[model samples]
Target chain A: MSGLILDFEKPIYELERQIDEMRNFAVTENIGALNEEIQRLEKKLARLRENIYADLTRWQRVQIARHPDRPHTLDYIAGMMTDFVELHGDRAFGDDKAMVAGMAKLDGMPVMVIGHQKGSDTKENLMRNFGMAGPEGYRKALRIVKLAEKFEMPVLAFIDTPGAYPGAGAEERGQADAIARVIYEMGRLTVPIIVTVIGEGGSGGALGIGVGDRVLMMENAWYTTITPEACSTILWKDQEKAAARKTDCAEALRLTAADLLELGVIDGIVEEPLGGAHHDFSAANQALKTAISESFAEITSTPIDTLILERIDKFSNMGVYDVVPADPV
Target chain B: MSWFKKPNSGPKKGDGDRRNIPEGLWIKCDKCDAILFKEDLDRGFRVCSKCGFHFKIGHQKYLSILLDEGSFEERETELRTTDPLQFKEKQNYPDHIKNYQKRSGLTEAVITGKGAIDGRLVSVAIHDPSFIAGSMGSVVGEKIARAIRRSIELRCPLIIISTAGGARMQEGILSLMQMAKTAIWLTRLSEAKLPYISLLTNPTMAGVMASYASLGDFTLAEPGAMIGFTGPRVIEQTIRATLPEGFQTAEFFYERGFVDQVIPRPELKETISRILSYFPDQSMSPESAEEGV
Candidate 1:
C-alpha cells in the first residue's frame, strides 16, 4: 500500500512504484546502469511530490489533515513529552476515548496535555470514535483542565476532531452543553492555555477546547467551520451539481491555516515538513514542542486576571466586519 | 463515532389520539394531522390544542407572552450587522439584510431587552426564526453577548429563547465564531453567580444549539421542538439511513436528559417566573447578598 495516497500524488507514486521494481531487478541482476536509473527516478519522484504539496489549495490541505499516516495525539506525546500519565472518565459518565487527557512533562515543565485522538487504522478509529468526541470526551477534557488549574499548571490542547458525534447517546448526554462548557471554562481559567489545531479542526468539536491565550494551527492543517463535503451539500445542494462546486465550498469556508491567520482567528501557523507532519514524525514533534514553549512563555508572563480578560476579548473581538457602503460592481 | 446508548426513540410523544374538527381558516397540524382553526391556535399560544404540536413563534410573540404587560424595553436596536463579509452568492448579504429587515422590522434575528417576568427584572433575548431562519450572525452573537453582560451588570437573571438552523453561512467563518463569543458571556454570568435560563424552541440546531443556548443553568424547551447540533436532513444524507421517529424533539431531549423540563406554551411564563424566584438576589435585595456568604 502507498499509505493513503491522494489523487494528486498519483504521478509521483507511479514513478516510485517503477523505481522500486527497477531497484529489485538491479540487485538481482547486478547491473550498475539499472541502479543508476533507479536513483535518478527516485530523485525525480521526490521533487514531483514536493512541488505538488508546496502551494496546495484548500481542498488539498483538507486531504492532508486526514492523511492516514499523520501523527496523532499519542504519537506526539511519545515523541516530545515525558512522564505522561493517562487520565480517564468524566466522572458523571463513562470514559470517552475520542478525547484523551493526562498529566505530562514538556522538557520537564509540568503541563496538562489534552487532545482528540483519531486512530491509525479502521479498528483503532472505531475505538477512538474517529476522534468525533461525544459529550463525555469534552467533559473529561474539562475535568483535566480544571485539575491543572487547581495546581496552577499550564494547559496544552491539541484539536483534531472531524466534529462532535451526532448520535443518539451523544445527543442524550448533552453534547452541545458539554462543548459550550469547555469553551466557557477555558476562557476564564486563570492558568495559561495554548491550543493547536493539529489536524481537521471541525466545527464546535474543535472549538470545545480551542480557546487559548494563543491559538495555533499546523501549516498543512485546516480549521473550517464545516467540512467541505458538508458545506457543498448545504450551499450547493445534492447530486452532480454539488460535487462540481465542493472546491468552491472549501474556498468559501476560509478553513486553511493561512486563511485563519488572515482572518485573525488564529495567532500563528507552525511549519510542517515538506509533505506534511506525516512525512517526518519526530521533526514535527520537535517543531510543536518548541512552538508550545515559546507561546507559553509569552502567555504566562501576563497577570492571571489580564490573561483571562484578554483571552475572552480575543475571541469576542474576532468577528467584527464593516458593511461596505456600496456593492462592488 | 456513535458514542451513546440509544436514547428515547419511539414515535412522537404528546401527539396522542386527536379528534377532527370541521375546517374553516383551517391549518393541518403537521405532527398529528388534526385540523386546527387559526383563531383557536392563537389563543393557545400557537400550540395545537388537541395534539400539542407547538407552532413556531417569533420574538415579538415571545416578549409579549413571557414578559409582564408592556414591560419589555428592547435593547441594542441601534446595533446593526456591518455585513462585514460583504458576502454574496445568489444575492449580496447587504441586500439580503435589507430584505429581512423590512420583512421582520427588527435590528437582528434576536430581540434582546430587559423586562419584568412576574414583576422580577430579567434580561431576555427572543429569536425571530423567520428572519433568515434566525441564523446567528455577528450582530446576533454580539447582541446576545452584550445582553448577558447587561444582566451581569444589572445582577439579574437572563433568559434566551433560541430557534435557528445554525450559523449564517453567508458570513463565512465569522458566523461560526459567534458561537464561542456568546458562550464566553455565559461563563461570566456563571462566575458572577447569575442564573441563565435557556429556552430552546422548534428547530434549534447547528452553532446556535451548540453555544449559550445549550449551557443554561436551568435549560428548558417547548414541546415538540427539534433540539440538536446537526439537523436530521444532514444526518440522513451523511449516514444514508432513515432516522427513527421523534428524532430531535423536545420530548425526546426530555427523555434523554438534555432538557430539564418540556413545558407547553401556556405554562412557560409561570415556570420561568418560578425559577427566577430561586435566584438569591431575586428574593432578597442586593445588600442582603453582600451581608452573607
Candidate 2:
C-alpha cells in the first residue's frame, strides 16, 4: 500500500497508524496490555474502513481507481498467469510499451492476455505514456489478437488506461484506425473473450480491447466516456474551471462501478477488498481469477456458430430504450 | 442563439438598402468579413459564396442533399435520451435535451434509417453537430447499431456521415460504451459482406473518429475537415512543440492513407452517388445509375 491517506480515510489511517505503533511497541517491549489495545484498534479500523468504502462518491472512487498501488497489468500477469511468453511488436511498426499482450495459460486454458500497463512512478509513466497506448500498441494488440484467433485461444483484456496516447505521432500513424480495427476484428472472433476493467476505463483506449462476451469492473474502478476533467472543460468551457469542477463532473458522469452496472454498461462488478484491490493483492488476484474462470465457463460452452452472434447481441443490448419491438431477429 | 442577435439593429435610415433587406437576417462569414444574406447562404448549402467556407449542416439537411426524392425512411426515431445519469451542470441534462430538442426539432444527435442514393437503397446515419456537438450517447449508439443491423437485414450498403466532438459528457461512461458498441455492429456489417462508407465532415475528433467513423470499408472525408483522435492544439501543448501546417486536416489524413478521399461539400452528393452506383442493385435499372444518377 502507498500508506498515503485520502481526506475521507484520515480517521481510518490514524487508527491503523496507532495500531501499527502499538504492535511495534508490543513486539519491542514484550507488553501484553498494548497488544490487546492494538487488537481492539485493528477491529475499529476495519469497521471504519468498511463504513467509509461502502459509500464512496464517484470522485473518491476515481482516486482509488488511480491509486499507485492498484495492481498493474504486469503484476496480474506475473501473479495470475502461467507460461506467459510476451510476444512483441505490431510487425508493421515498432513495439509499443503501453500495451503489453502475449500468450498465456489461465487455469489450464490457453488465452491471449492483453492489457494496458501503467507505470508506478514518473520515469516509468513516461516510458509507458501513463498507460495510454499509441497506434503501434493497438496494432501490436491486433497482431496478437489475430494470432490468438489462429490458435483458437480465448482472449482476456485487462483494461486500465487514461486514454489512447494523444501524441501527434500516434495520430499520424492513425490511432483511430488502429483502435477501430482491433474492435472490429475482435468482434468477429469466434473464441470466447472476457474483459476485466481493473482500473480506469477511459474512452476508446479501454474499448480497444473492451469488446467481449462478458465485461467486468473492479469495485473501486471507474469507467467513463471521458475523464471528469475533460467533461468539465467541455461543459464549463474553461480549462482552469475544469480542474475545480471535476468532482461535480465526476458525480454527474455516473462512472463508478455501481453506477455503470446499474446503467447496463458493465456485466459484473468484481469485489475489491475494503481497502481496495491495492491493500490485498492476494484476495484481488483470487477474485479476478475466479471472475475470469466463471466468465469463461459461461461463454466457452456456446457453440462456435453462435458465439460471435452472442457477442454482438451482448453489446447490442446495452443502451437506452429499444425502438424496435422485442421480437427476436 | 447568437445567430438571432440583430447585427444591424441600430436606428435605420430608410434609403440605406432597406428595400426587402429582410431585417435581422444577415450573418458575418467566419472566413470573410462580408455579411451574407441568410436566404442566399442557405440556398448555397450554407457555404460562403465568396470564400468557399463550408458551414456545418444538420443531419436532416444531409439527408435532403444526399438521398433521392421522398426515399428516406428513418428508423428508431423514438429512442430518445433517457438521461440515465440525471447529470446537471449549467443546467440539468433533461433541460439541455429539452432546449436542443426545441431548437433543432430532433431528439438526439444522429438520424439513422434507410434512403436511396441514386436509385440504390443504403442504410444512412447522419450526425448533427448542433445537437450536443454530435456526441455519441447510448441512444445515438443504439440507433447507429440498429442502422447497421438494418443494412444487414436488408442486405444493403451502409453510410454514416460523422460530424462529432466526441462522446456525450452527461451520459458519462455509457456514452463511451457507444464507441465499442458502434464498432461492434460495423464488424457485423463487414462480416455479412455489407460495405460501410464512413463520411467524415468537419471536426470528427476523439471517440467518434476513433471508432466506427474510422473503421469504414471506404472512408471519405470532407475537404479541410479536422479528422483526428485529438485536437491538434491539445497535442501540441502536450508535446510542447509547434505542429506542421495542416497537421490534422482531411488532406493530411489523405496523405497518410487514413482517409480514402476528401470530397468537397458541393461534390459530396455526386461522389456518394457514384460510389453507390459501384454496388448496383440487381433488381432495378438494369445497368445501374452509372455516371450521374
> Who wins the DockQ comparison?
2
Pairs with steric clashes in candidate 1: none
Q: Candidate 2: DockQ? A: 0.46
- Candidate 2's residue-wise lDDT over A1-329, tens digit each? 45567788888878877888889888899888786777778888878988998888889999988988889998889888899999888998898999999988887778898899998887898898899999999999888888888999888899999889989999999998899889888888777888999999988888888988889999998888888887788778877787889899898888888888898878898998887888899899989889888988887678866988877777777776435443221
**Strongest candidate by lDDT:** 2
Candidate 1 chain A — worst ten consecutive residues by lDDT sum?
A320-329
Instruction: Using TM-score, give the best candidate's number.
Output: 2
What's each prediction's clash count? Answer: 0, 0
DockQ numbers for every candidate? 0.28, 0.46
Distance from true position, residue A87, model 1, in Å?
A: 1.4
